[model samples]
Target: MTRPQHFGWFLARGFGPQGWGYPSLDWDYDWTRPEVYQEAARTLEQAGFDLVIIEDSPSLGSPETIDLRVRHAFGGPKHDPLLLAPYLFQATRHLGVVPTVNPAASLPYTSARQFATLHHLSGHRLGLNVVTDTGSARHFSDAPQLGHDEAYDRAEEWLDGIRSLWHSWDDGALVADRATDVYADGSRLRPVAHRGRHYAFDGPLNALPFTDGEPAIVSPGGSGRGLGFAGANSDVQLALAPLHEKSVRDYRARVHEAAVAKGRRPEDITILFAIQPVITSSSEEADRIVAASARPDDAALQQIARKQSSDLETDLTALDLDRPLDLSIFGAHVSRGSIQRLIGDRGEDAPLRAHLTALARAGRLSDRTGFVGTADEFADLVEELGDWGNDGVLLWGDFHPVTLHRTLDELVPILRRRGLLRREYADGGLQANLRSF
Candidate 1:
């Protein structure tokens, strides 16, 4: 029997109000309130998505100065996803809440305790997206920001410490029996004396054992270091859905090979590509919608510039948008992955200035790839990906409530009818749902 494809949503605008595709999103609406996100989580539960990955960053930059950050509200003023997870869990039963955690910023012992607590409370409907802080390391503390490889190396030790703490209290340690006047089996509990290059933890976690087993682990980075870590550790790996067939095959194969080398079956780790679907009632209508959404105006273009500058960690406001950009100046600060996707093979000796200028002019605020079509056509795309052995997709376009409802109400049913998506959730929480595929 063919396994049903797993589905998840990458909630890009956790609580942000401004983003592409949603023009009518209320700017004054309070993002701190639970109702804003709870409604979306409940909708996903109805859609039968396996999980919702919430992204966060402590170092939201002010690239073009305070005005840019305040004007765009791009990545700042963010609420803690941990505090918001409970609301989502309370709003829905099966939709797993996976929040990104930067190990460099949060201690492993604290992460373990918090995740374990959520696991117990949510019946194992929890996942942690381990992230090595890429933003300024100074923001995390006084510690210098380690290089990319070093960050992952430290993350490896951090994860080991967390696992040790989690296992400190063995199974069946909690025996609430009044007859013996004892609650926990003291002998079964042990302490984790973990001291590593980056972190040190001495003793057992001051928390109950995780209920319904360990919460699912998700790894999203695609760097070489990230691939190795994900292959060895993550239950699910989040990646960008490629635009070409060869890219898809190569990416999946590489990750599977990594898993195999690590003594893990390829099936043990599920890979979900990030996608956004532009759904409409008909092909022509979809095309018309796409056309309408295209060609953003001057104000929007400026916002895009601000956002790109923030990501590149350099202010491009003063640079001539039309002149050939001196690529040497950007240096290593430019994200290599972003460059590959945007420039592709056309970047060989090409002037880099036009690329950045083009991005701003085109109003390409985000790199999130999407399919614009009728529901049936979108289903075909999903089926094609599954046929290529891709596990599933993670959807997110805008933070607008309408987009979430339309995806759940219109696109989901089409996918279910075509047998490309699960019609109902599995018997347990997020982990069970992920394993069900």
Candidate 2:
């Protein structure tokens, strides 16, 4: 029998325009309103998902690239996901809502208080998807931008400071003695005075102690320092890698090694790989979709260019497709990983058209853990991951009802029948739900 695995939904587009550039936009639900997302949150909880992780980029890129970021509604004009978490909590009973938060954007004290209040309000189902994107430093009062490793170093300090505040209220701090009308014991509160390299704060956090646990910590970093940060601090590691068994096992092993180095057990962190699978009705239909993608026409290639341009924060559509891309066109702030993903197996010398075409190509479900498949075929991959000692998977897409149903309607029952997806949530909050498996 296969052990059950956890499941989550990733709001890949963040709190930006939903259903944009898709046929579903015709559904006529206002993206700015709370009702659409609330309905989707309810649907996810009913589907037995453990959490929903929201992705955010606090800045619209530097002044030079703002147009590329939002022209196609790919990157910016995002309302804070942190602000949307409450509405999601109001709509669902058990689903955890994790919003992306950058350490540089807000003060540690402010983040701690706000997150603590939400964690308590949501019955401990809140999570913080901590990110270390230095690109948004300019928006935060000209915060000092650090190098890659140094950013992680600062994040470590930032997280430590937050945790210090969370623990400032001791276990017995809340006495709640009705007989004497004493709500809390002041003596039990510890005065936290932290002076770190990255941040300094004094706190006996005004928020009360968490009865269940502090808000869950989620991290998405794949670098060596990134993995180390996840191992030392994260409760859930938002992972990205190939879905093949060996690759999955290797990635898990690296996280485990890092955890052991930090004197933590491997099981302390749940590693959830991000996947965007194309679910089809039949194998033949899946085959047809894959075949059509092998040679994308001009229109399809241009569509791909728009997305790539948004992600790279550089315009690819304006470039001559026949000529090789000049690496110098990308600004210093562009993510190296985003650039590498755009230029996959092909070298930098390859023409821009070749690179885009490679990205446009699609693979079959039977092709080495490929994603294009029927529901049963997709279940096979999920079961295989469970057998490989995998923790879980996060399905990536928009946070709209249409998008959720399109993916989960056919896939959920198949997974549950195979004992791969959870059928019910446990009593504790999100952390409890993750650990219940």
Candidate 3:
């Protein structure tokens, strides 16, 4: 309970219409070039953001599907975020670095050791976004099939083994008691023998006690089984519902309530939602950007969004505004909670074409569907989303570095003017910055 902070938020870009996503899925990636991404990371940290997260997927969609497109792997030869985030720590000073890792790629023992080292190397500024890849097992070089919830079932053992290893190096355990000549107290470190339904691991990870300020866990479980697992252990309960402040608020409150029922403090977990922000000098300019994005010929919204449509004949941009929406043409199966959210509001009698177009419109234009407007209005949404229960919102941009700079150059100043966001950082490390609240 170090941070009594009323609000907390982080910025990130992955799965946007831009590089990390579209190109990863085998589209053009002119927006997210290497230098642009580096600059984007630099700018977000410089803007005094609490943290910036980078994510990964060994195989985006299901790797086993006969169709290569089914895996939905974004970007060609995508880099590893686990390896990428750590490299940024020394380059940028304060921004908390979190990387999403596919646990199935590396066992818990190895993952824990690496992250524990990251916590130490980064001055306790490391964070984790845990995603159990049950579906990815089929892609592995040497692993049997693990079902959906089955992956999460193994996560319990993974976490238990990982936590024990982190705690193995207890307080003052590594002291150089000169006269005592004790490098570490042998009695303090304990072995964790974990034999669970899905996994079995003996002893501790090959890492010293992360000592202090180990990476905080961000639990985001989208399914029913995942929820209970996440609710129990996450420092931040991360999830994205439809783009409604009310739903965002209610969902977060439910997560907090779930933690309370588990005999844990509600404030122990923070709710953070995904928000795509497009900022401009005025509302008109922002609107134009949204309009263009909503109609981007290259967006591939119907396909890129994991939507259930293929072989779309017409250019969605040519759609006339007067037509009714038909929701049936789009097949019943689509991924992400967002699809369900959009479909819930569909009219039964609506034309499938119109409904599909609107859904396409919503996905194509990042700013159009998100909190968009002038700096002031954008700030208002940030505050409102916060008031609704999210400690903070994750920012996704259409263009990598340019859009990030806009936030620093325009929106951040406005937020500072309103006395909402901090202009200067508080002294202390990650814990100190958060504890100041």
lDDT by candidate, in order shown: 0.73, 0.89, 0.58
How far in Å is the alpha carbon of 94 misplaced in model 1?
0.9
Per-residue C-alpha lDDT of model 2 across residues 1-437, encoded as one tens digit per residue: 77988888999899989999899999998888889999999999999999999999998887877888888799878999999999999998999999999998888888999999999999999999998888888888765677788888988998899889989988789999999999999999999999988788899999988888779999987889999999899999987787887889999999999999999999999999888889998999999988888899989999999899888888899999999999999876666767888987688899999999988987876675357888898888878888899999999999888999988899999988988888888887998998997
By lDDT, the better pick of 1 and 3 is 1
Q: State, as a TM-score between 0 and 1, how close model 1 is to the true structure.
A: 0.90
TM-score of 3: 0.78
The predicted structure with the larger TM-score, 1 or 3, is 1
Candidate with the greatest lDDT versus the true structure = 2
TM-score of each model, in listed order: 0.90, 0.97, 0.78
Q: Stretches of candidate 3 above 4 Å error?
A: 1-37, 60-76, 141-144, 242-245, 287-344, 347-352, 360-370, 426-435
What is the lDDT for 28 in model 1? 42
Model 2 Cα RMSD, 1 decimal: 1.3
Candidate 3 residue-wise lDDT, 1-437, digit = tens: 11112233343334223434433424344533344455656676666676666655455443223243333333223456666665567666776777776666776677788888888788787888777755456576566766656666677667766787777666766777889777777676667776666556665556666534557777666667766776777766667777576777678767877778778877777666666655667777766655765663434544533334211211223333335434443332222343354445665455444455554553212243555577787777666665565566566543355456655578777776665565555554454444434
Kindly state the number of residue pairs that clash in model 1. 1
In order of lDDT, best first, we have 2, 1, 3
Query: Candidate 1 lDDT (Cα, whole model)?
Result: 0.73
RMSD of each: 3.5, 1.3, 6.0
Candidate 1 lDDT over residue span 35-134, tens digit each: 7678778878887889988877666653444455545665565677778898889998888999877787778888888888888888789998887765
